[model samples]
Target chain A: MRWLRYLGYALGGILLAGCVAFLVAAWIYRDIPAGVLEAKYTTPASRFLNVDGVRIHYRDEGSGPPLVLIHANFASLLSWDDAVESLKNTHRVLRFDMTGHGLTGPDPSGDYSLERTVELTGRFVDALQLEHFSIGGTSLGGTVAMHYTATHPERVDRLILLSPGSLEGRSMQRAGRAVPKAADILKYIAPRALAEFMLTSRFGDPSRVTDKLIDQWYEMWMREGQRAAILARLRSYSSADIVKVTAAIRVPTLILWGEENPQAPVEQAAELRQMLGSAPGVTIITYPGVGHMAAEEAGPAIAKDIQTWLAAPTVRQKESVPP
Target chain B: MIAARPQLLSLLLLMAQAAAAQTQPAMDAKGWNLDTAPQSKTATPAEPPSTLNMRVYKDFDGRQQRIGDTSYAVDVSAVMTRCNDGSLIITALVIGGQLTPLDNHCPTTSK
Candidate 1:
């Protein structure tokens, strides 16, 4: 009889805890409607294009050679603000938030595969009537630009890869493996600290992760349907057969890496240079204290280097590539 | 016992964000705006509380919409960012009101 009483108490406690958790979440974490976030976070340079049914948020600045940049996973076009300012003065710099990220939110088609992202990129440039342009990306974006350049060699004049990711070894189901078992709970209860922690982890210098930056990131996460779209994208993540994909790139290539990049470390920079063997010319640069977000970490320096490389003739120009 | 950790963390984060949520960064800077764009092409731009470029789509989308018909589109938004003079310049960038062609989907609201 006493054991039965203990079981009843346990059940009651569990119910109470669940109720408290629910109430707490409800009070602090309501999804910020997309319209509200857009009005609050949209910058002076923001533009919206309804492409393939996805309202892609992007920026096109400067007025020379066109350069299209892609941001890293979980990040928006705002990540490249510093780099854009430096490059926009010379080349026509363009960058966009990937579907399911930033103001773009969820993709209406529900397709989050890498191939879809690449296709979206094609559609975007085609919409702009940009026949030819220099393509670049950071983190996940770097990987997409590489894939796009390989698939559409005619449209890409040069390729810039900054800490790109590859699913060469992750072709199988890798959902929620490194992720905590309680990952699903995250979709509903995203604490602001969690965002700060993630950004700080990615940054080489944690001190650089400012409160304002965290607010922007948190607000983006809070955007309506954004978190669900992000999780869906993660679950649907798969390789675009990136094995030996770099070898197919024949245009000039530039690879940038941060020495402290915990994810795609600087060591892989050498491997990337070797992989782009078919490229007419490859220049690889490594920043000492930079991390995965090199564009934001050392934007001006990267912009200066990119400007110089763009001006110089291609083909074995710099000895930066590892021999 | 372990379940309590996430709840505690959430409470702490809520407090932290509240403490950090001062509009000084927004007020000190220019403005913010995004898809608050008019659905009908012929609609007038809304007078926002703090949005900077809430005009005809003429920037990123390349003057896609003007005063009467088109506009622009860009993709960078930052709050509390100190400008060159370190002062926020929030104003409506109503370009030269250049008369651009209206999109087929966008009807002329000049009636």
Candidate 2:
């Protein structure tokens, strides 16, 4: 009887300890103040446009032919900071945070589907009165760009895809299936630490994962409703849906793939080439030792390739189309 | 034992309370808000691509049978050729019966 009482005490103590630990973790990892993130991330060039009840945060720089750039999942427009700098001199560069990302906050409709993103892109272009423009995207952004061009072929002149997501490959198919489940689990657990691990793992060279970069990403994730929005977006993604629309894109496309991309494997570039083979102009370039974040990993080389491709006769002719 | 039962019941109740508190939604934090800004009536663009471009591909059935004396195979569905200068060219099997020139090098032929 005494032993039973001791066992009861032991069980109660263990339960108490676990509850305290969980409470402490939840408090510590609660969303950081939005003001703190804005102070750290908002730049002088930062501007906002109201698009379909979503306040889009964007940056428009330089002067020339208009070029719209979109970032990958869990990344903001700042992902294209280097690429924008490299291209702004010769081309008008526009980069914006997609809905549910960066400071854009969550969509009221809670529709983070690729179709919603495509619609947002179109509205954004229309808002800017960009009749004919070139578009580039990385990762999920790449997938969005392909879908955008497929639907609005007349508006998009050239398409630049860097490590675009695909369902054709076994690895990416598995990733597509795994992401929503992972996001569901992550939304309820310790998100910041897991997100940091994920961000670091995506880089081929982990040394590139700087403290400042991690801090920015962590702060962005801490934005109110950002976590839920990310989960919603992840849940909405369908690689099979993307693979289908990508084939119909008629604009000139330049695919820059990292040789060792883990998330969207390098082999998908070949599959993309096959899908976009019917497009009038298709150029595929592979960087020998880069990873998924090609825009950040190989910015200079990518920028140079993009500049050359944009200036090429094929793209120039396409750019001349009337609004 | 009666006294111990009362103590045990209290401990169990406390444990249940702690578990409930811990499971509460994190969004209910005091300062958190949805941060809704002034709504804008920016004209929504025309509906974007809603349907998938489900183009069906003709399935080819065969094993690794060679296509004549050339380095191409019926099963492989790829052609390999060695140039006069020792360069090699390989063809890709395009779906939908379209064969585009794939500018990739063949490692086997190069060796």
Candidate 3:
């Protein structure tokens, strides 16, 4: 009887301890306030436009022909800050935080699918009343830009695909399977430490992962509705679906790649070129030692390339939609 | 009970490490070799002559047609800037040889 009583006491103690530990963890991993995040990330040029009930955060600067830039998944418009500064001198640049990212928060309808993103981008362009413009994006943003140009070729004067997403291929297929599972797990266990670690891993050089950058990324990830939105976007589409849509793009395309990109390997650049073989113009430039974050890593060089490409007599032509 | 407490503590530590590991890539080395390599540079074309003459023409059909010894096609309702080197930079719709900006009047709320 004494042994039985001791066993009961031990079990009760263990249960009480477990509850305390869980509560502590929850408190430690609590989301950062949106006000704090905005103070850190919102720049003087930061502006918001309501598209389909979603307020999009964007920056518009410079003068000359309009050039719209889209950021990668899990990133905001600020990711293109260096690139924007380099391009703004000679071009009218517009970069916006896509829905479910950065200051944009999340989609009101809880739909973060690529199709919905494409529709939102179309609406954004229409809202700006851009008769014709050049479009560019990095990673998932690259894929989004491709889809937008495919759907509205007459509106896109030129296209830039910077380390674009490729889910159909073998390397990306593996990433496609693993990323969603990780996001699913992360939705429930979103510790700031874990978020910071993930952001650091995206960079090829850990030294480039500054304390300020990590803090900004962690705060944005903890923003209201952002976690759920990111998870939904990860689970929304398949590699096969992306391949079907990408095969139809016919705009004059320039593909920039980081040779050492582990997430989206440099070999995928060749595949993208092949997929865009039918484009009126296809130019692929690979930075030898760079990695996944080329826009951030090699911003000035890329801006120069874009300016040169735009001025090239061979690439300059009136936009036309294919039959 | 004392033995179980140590075991439980170790288990919690292991779980935390595992969660941290999950956030990183599985590759052995995540760093890229950027220091040793020379940065890629884009070749810039020679600037056009500053004193070159400028001419413009009106294109009613929005086509790049040459007009009287000058290769200029002015799309109606478009803002066209003819460079000193005879290059054309268009910013808006060209309607009847006049530049018309797009009606982008969306309200912006500053953050």
Candidate 4:
């Protein structure tokens, strides 16, 4: 009886210590920047598209030619809302929530890799029946677009990347090197609350965090098996196996970066330019005072540059589609 | 004032268009200017039609495209320069007519 009493006290002490450590670590971890998620644009055309069994919510409006825009991780189609509306009067813009983020429900299979996203983009284009189109993406999406262009140059007329995930395959390899295997499990423990903490830290300015946006993000986090999907994505990121696909991109690529983008600094963009050196025409543009959210922070400026770059009217012309 | 004349005129035109468009909720003036092309719901397997139309709103210096007011509704792609801060705006909105400017006109009040 005495021994059992002592064992119980020992277990209680261990539990108490673990709780204290977790609370303290949580407080310290709170310092990391979380991303701002929301439908910030005033555009009413934002809707969802059911493509490949995923209800991809997108912002589709405007008039002229077609331009498909892809957003980075932890972002939705709303990230491109400002740029889309600004250019919609003269250009038709397509911006959608990728498989895992935004209103687009989580992928039940948890296949959020760049290759999968590239396939999804192709399906999106096919679904729209766009034979040839100009495409641009930011962060993770940029890497996927670059890969897609390399593999299916026939489909992509022009490509633009904004602070793409990794300009060089080595960066991804390096990122994969440090991925924590069990860290993702923490993503599921009290997920809704933890996600709030994690996402809020992605932003430099916490004031950008809004109630509506937080609610939306929380809802998405709690969606069917989202925690598992996030874990799967983390596992994919840690695999560090993005070389063969990225090494083969051959399209005209434009790499844009924010001078202050911390996640993917200017060096990464330079590395991307170096890797795709064999491409016909690859241009790298950098802006000052911009961060990971360069498109949103400098949406107006980024949009204008893209318009000019696409209009240079110098790329190899393909057979015109039937009018 | 003459140098400012074009900008003032442009602003007024934009404001008037915005106001008129606001009046007729069902009818959109911007898309109206686009070619009356037929749109089908079924996805086309063939090459997409060249509905590409490019428009450039040059900066006040007449060097680069103007920002803020530039439309992605027409061009296959566009570059805009913000008139106020003079920043470069790169956009891929024109390629497949994916631009949506609806949010710019909405109220700040959440729906």
Candidate 5:
């Protein structure tokens, strides 16, 4: 009877231990909603460039003149989803994720320089048989677009820059331009967590971040050779190149700014305006109460300006000019 | 034998309490403020306390993990409230620096 009592107590204790362990595990690995996780894994709109062996993820819907959209760092074609919807009816909009970004191929050549992006744009334009087009981009994309326009002035019609980061003088002053070097450290730590932190921090709202979102970025980061390409691009890229390209841009340029954007403050826009020297022709529009994503925050207004600016006589003249 | 068992049990209980205390980080007592009352499971922002900014942290096995990724939101209940001003001021809780109104948190009024 005493042995039976001891056995009962041991069994109860074991059951309790099992229950506790189960509870702790359940808390740690909470169920993720299927819809949310699946949504993150949906493949982006894609196109293959025969010349470069690059699978360019883009949204190319619309009718009128070609308008190419370029997104910022750590962003894919979806960043311009709002613009694509607004302009698809009137403009043949195009947006491609830069190499090492989104679903695009990580160029084995380790070439993510502004020149390579410009070259890829040229190839893509040629492949699509686009005679001339209006081009614009945000942040890093803006810099690439500017360089492309300046280098191949004949092919580009007009320019739209959204808080571009191209001031070499000031960029040099900032200590941590070592994006590539930092990437190595991030790689050693949890890559998914770091990417999530980097991306989530950029947004004005923290509540928007979700676990499934981090998982998708993690999958993308896991793509072989992608991290290397991203790091290489970071190490090789120079602000001086972008700054130098700005002066050579002869097309009608439109500068877009977000009032509360911490990344590219309004002061940078003011400086770009001063340096461009096309005060009347070069228009600077600000979206108050918006963050880095002004086009998204004020889509209709931006679309209207783009449509009008594209129709301007000078921009038209540049488009008609032979490449 | 009974006395010896009781003494052993007391010692074990004390050790367990010490372990628990050691593992748990000291809560910032001053920052404790009233969050909103419990709300339905509808998609809404996580209600925050007016007195203190409650950063979204995942307390897993007593470890605080910073949540990241701006793709979806987590659901939390604002069951507890701390006295602040005359009226309960409710701000949405944020995990990362970004804040969106999509988080689902139980409102303080639900109680």
Candidate 6:
């Protein structure tokens, strides 16, 4: 009977400790809704529109032909500010906070797969009455852009991939066996420091990762439902359809890389150009000391190149079945 | 105007294109017009047929091809140029091969 009482006491103590830890985490890592975030973060350029049941936050600027830019994972439309400032002078640059990131928050449909992203992008473009526009994106956005161009070759005039992830080697994109309920656990414990660490690690020049950049990233992460949505996106992500599509893209493709990109090495650019087998011709550009965030890190350079590419004739591309 | 210098330079280049000894293949335009041969799904065993990165000595008129000769221009090269403002412009009938720069014009301080 005494032994039984002792076991009961031990279990009670463990429960008490767990409850305390949960309370602390719940307080520190609580999600903040979009309304609160928008009040603090959005600028004069910010515009909101509902696309695929998500009230997407986007910005449209510049004046020439339409160019739609998608941001990286854990980043917002603001990520392309430097490039957009220069591009707007000659082009209509449109950037959106994707379904799970920035002020857009999460998709009500509860879907955050790359395919879901492509579908959302198409509907968004159609909603805006864009008959045809050039498309470009970085990292996760890069993957989505490539997926979109592959499937909707007719709709895209041009395609740009800035340090896109694992299109050639899907196995390497998310290596290691799945840890059960890991994403579930992550939903409850995101720290701003981790965001800072991740951003700095991806940057070719960490000195450029200012306090404002980290704050913007963390604020987006803290947006209500976003942390969970991001985790869901990573867990549900698939590059299974990429290889076939990469081979099917017939439009002129541009592959840009930062020589020091840690996330997707510069070598991957060569692999991607080879992957762009069907693309009539692929242009590869490497910024000597840039990194994964080339758009942010080397904005003017990319923008000028984009301007030149856009001015060129539309290279007729092959259509394919991919989504 | 995009920039006075670029605009002026573009006009000069246009003039140069008209006067150049070889007036680009009659079928061609401003940049090399990419051929209509579409790339197949299994582009692995055999490389797609296109002249990848043949440098254009001068920029011409794409519309000239559109209005006159063929469906689209065929001889295309992906061209990346560094502008005076330190910006870059990449031109193309771009498609295949490992994209190494056809020419790198790094600015030197001395004349």
* Fnat values, candidates in order: 0.00, 0.00, 0.01, 0.01, 0.00, 0.06
Order of the predicted models by lDDT, top scorer first: 6, 1, 2, 3, 4, 5
Clashing pairs in 2: none
Rank candidates by TM-score, best first: 6, 2, 1, 3, 4, 5
Residue-level lDDT of model 4, residues A1-323, one tens digit each, is: 99999999999999999999878765543321212223433247767667777766677777677888888766666667567757776678888877767666576556787667777888887887877877888877777777777778788878888887754335667555545776764553444465455445544344555566555556555444555565566556521334455556666666676665667765565345434534545544555556677766667767766766676544421211112
Could you give candidate 1's per-residue lDDT for residues A1-323 as a string of tens digits? 99999999999999999999887996688788999988987877788998999999988788999999999888888888888888998899888889988899989898988889999999999999999999999888987898899999999998888888763224233433443447777677889999888888888888878898788888998888888788877776755566568769989877666667787756565456545646665555555566777777778767766776687655432111001
RMSD of every candidate to native, in Å, equals: 22.7, 23.1, 20.6, 15.6, 24.4, 11.5
lDDT of 3 by residue, A1-323 (tens): 99999999999999999888867766666666767777877878888899999998888899989999999888788778778887898888989988889999989988887889989999998998998999999988887898898889889988898888754333556654545464564554577676567656666565666677666677788887788788888777533455556657766677777656787866566456545534654555555446687787667667766776676644322221111
**Candidate 3 residue spans exceeding 4 A from truth:** A1-5, A168-185, A316-323, B1-111
What residue runs in model 6 are displaced by over 4 Å at the alpha carbon?
A: A1-15, A166-169, A173-180, A313-323, B1-111
As for DockQ, the candidate ahead, 4 or 6, is 6
Error of 4 at B92 (Å): 25
Candidate 4 matches the true fold with a TM-score of 0.60
Off by over 4 Å in 5: A1-45, A168-176, A180-182, A188-192, A205-219, A278-280, A295-301, A311-323, B1-111
Give the range where candidate 5 chain A is weakest over 10 consecutive residues by summed lDDT. Answer: A314-323
DockQ (model 6, Cα) = 0.06
CAPRI quality level assigned to candidate 3 from its DockQ score: incorrect
Q: Which of the numbered candidates is closest to the native, going by highest DockQ?
A: 6
TM-score, one value per model:
0.70, 0.70, 0.69, 0.60, 0.58, 0.73
Tell me which of candidates 2 and 6 scores higher on TM-score: 6
lDDT of 4 by residue, B71-92 (tens): 3111222211122244222221
Q: Please compute DockQ, using alpha carbons, for every candidate against the native two-chain complex.
A: 0.01, 0.01, 0.02, 0.02, 0.01, 0.06
Residue-by-residue lDDT tens digits, candidate 2, A7-107: 99999999999989877776777766666667777888788899998899888898999999999888888788778888999999999999878888788
lDDT of 1 by residue, B1-111 (tens): 011133322322232222223222111111222123212222112211122112212222223233233112111111111122222222111112111111111112210
**Candidate 4 — number of clashing residue pairs?**
75
Candidate 5, residues B1-111: lDDT per residue as tens digits? 011133322322332232222333222222211121122222112221111111122221222222331122122211111111122222222112222222222344421
Top candidate on TM-score is 6
